[model samples]
Target: MSILVRGMHGLGDNLHQRAVIRQLMARDEVFLESSWVAPYHDLVAAGLKILRKATPLRTQSKNADREASLFHRGPLPPRAQEVRITYTPDLVRARGSVLAAMCWATATDYAAADFRMAVPAEWLQQAKLLFNAWQPRKPVLVYRPLVDRTEWGGCRNRNPDHGAYAALFDAIRDDFFVVSIADLVPGQEWIVSRQIRADVELHKGELDFETLAGLFKLSAGVFASPGFAVILAQAVGTPVACVFGGYENSSSFAGGARFSPTLGIDPINPCQCFSHSHACQKSIDIPAASARLRAFFAEAARHWPGCA
Candidate 1:
């Protein structure tokens, strides 16, 4: 019998959960139920079945603990083996991959397989067509800035100021066609400075999740704050440079540490704040983050000479 599972709400979280799902599938048939499963179509292609359901919109509340608990305790289907994965302080303190943490929490054995996803041949063709249509003069580097609303649990402190990123764009625009996929709400369009925006090819609308994944697969590299794009890029084996705002605590939580040892820049200092807090007192050093991205691009260029 197949074990039914509920997936995480965010793309990155869900991607991390794939590792756990793979481990489960090895022992029993796995059926994943999630409203936000478009990003995991690749997983479906790889043999996992999904039951689509719409996720409820999250709202800000004074009771942070209650809100957090609600997300951690996702819906459990009757008759299916339920894996109770909670994002507790203890789990965060473990400083391991969320997949491993989940396994440990449930007393299940951890599988050491590298994270993997399947991109359909058709998706590759689509990406190629899209790339050619854009006619970029240089190799493409996708950048996803932290542009979600303040109420959305994206820590404001982690978001780089416009000037810092614009400087980074100026530093690299001569060598690569930079693409910005920051999700901008109306009236907040200027958050990305004019200097950076001028240099970047803006992907304005919300991208179909599959298309975003396809673009990540085809890019020379990716640069972004820790979010869906960063995780997706890493999953597809694309080199990634990530800027961690004061939210990541890889030393404590497995999810926080999952991106470590990958081709990316982690926060220079340990972040003591909660991952979703709006009250984080610490912020990333923009100039230093920019430098790390520059180095990442340089290394990627060496390995992928075609992009140089």
Candidate 2:
């Protein structure tokens, strides 16, 4: 049987689908989206076909938008069975992880799935060279700027006070070599400037996708808002100290959806506010968060030899 797995909504969603895709590749021929091809260099080399679709024009009309969506999503072979993956909170809680939830969606065995990302040998080598150049004397800690979703109904519920991150980074400065990572839009460096100053900056173009995943594998851990960075770290077997705000806890993304049980980090929201509204105005406790992150990294270092 031939399978056409539709592309997911975001980078993290696409990463979660990797295990499911691998399961399909073992049983049948599989085709994936062009946008989804970059992160899975290994899978592509292993025989995953890139789905080709006609490009659509940019337009504001509803009918034109619908047509564009169809153009990118359709023209499937009549004999090929298409699989559309969907997400729900209930399914995620039941399966214990988003990867498991997706596995269940595609009739794949959840226990047998492997979520670790495999990059090319060259990428790993390049990452090691980059790490050595830094001469990092302490355990490396990744610091990503706080960025909220900008499209498809933006959610600010998980956004904490930008100043909180600065304090956290400052507390860990002497013990950790911080590497700030973000792809800021032109004239938008304030997104990171407000977060914290780091020993090194890896903005856009500093490294490619696979190489960055390789760097994550070598790091002690990462501090990020709930998003793709957390998923990327988990995929590469790196510990992540997810800095969550009051509106939403790790249950939605970090701890619940994409939690790696072996990592041993409970990225829960520790704030006084729990309003479901997107405009939630609760402040996160940075001092407490910093303490937990320090402890989390200490534990990770005990097990992960890469921390040295």
Candidate 3:
């Protein structure tokens, strides 16, 4: 029987997860690598065989007293009974699809493989086909200044909070089409600035793969905040205004774009958390950000054309 398992953890990331499924599907009778987890439903439907592994649940507590009562767990079902699994709390199990994903085989793996399934040639567009097809064809632009925060590590919510960011965005919105997929979406009443009361909606998609890449190519430009999206955009030859932080770019995969990384080391645990996303929250100014954005889009216009 083919064995499917997850050696990584945290519901996994986008790239790590997709590569696993893609690699496993190529096998014959061997179908999936469920990795002995419960979240294999959606991924299995996409392909890959979800197998069952018969392994007893380990005790979460190391205390002797608690360890004694760890036997309360029961065995998995028959489909699960046919296999054995290894404990991989970190989730980095792309034995074969690693090169395609373009990261080090030694890089920590994740089950949430968003990028692997999000970009690439066919994958990116196909992933968004269902969603983008429905967006009102009103010349939508992905306005993400979050990259500035990631660049310098200076907490400049300037767009709305840091300074005049909210006003700047409002000004731009009045004359141009805009939408936001910010890292943290405050409450509708939170009012980034004066609560212009703008709304951004999400639509579900059902694209195959190749189509996904096409959409990325069509984008005017990507205003990002040092995240995987920027990397993916660059892969498709789309220009990226990376609002990033820290000179040490751990997530810098294959790409060629300007790194508008933020400032500040915040030395004593700058992010308060090591994750890259948090670093960007500190930098990024509004007026300065707006000027850069206009330039980036204008540059994109030279290639995509027909924009103000």
Question: What is every candidate's alpha-carbon RMSD to the true fold?
Answer: 6.6, 6.0, 11.7
My TM-score estimates for the predictions, one after another, are 0.77, 0.77, 0.42
**Could you tell me which residue pairs clash in candidate 1?**
35-53, 92-252, 92-253, 93-252, 94-252, 95-252, 95-253, 96-254
**Model 1 agreement with the true structure over 1-308: per-residue lDDT tens digits:** 55777656666767767767767777876777554554555565566666553544331122122223322243444688765444655565563555566667655565563455766777777677777777777677887755645445544665544455555555655667777775555643324434354335554555555677777787777766656766677677777765554655433223323433244444445564555654443344667766666676877756653421
Error of 1 at 126 (Å): 1.1
Best by TM-score: 2
The residue-by-residue lDDT of candidate 2 on 70-151, one tens digit each, is 2234355568888776656567667655666787787888777765686567777877887888998778877887754344
Show model 2 residue runs off by greater than 4 Å.
52-78, 93-96, 187-193, 253-277, 285-287, 302-308
Residue range with the least summed lDDT across 10 consecutive positions in model 3: 261-270
> Candidates 2 and 3: which is better by TM-score?
2
Clashes of each: 8, 0, 62
For all candidates in order, the CA lDDT equals 0.58, 0.64, 0.36
Compared with the true structure, what per-residue lDDT tens digits does model 3 show for residues 189-253?
A: 12232333333422122221234344445555544444444554644456655433432222333
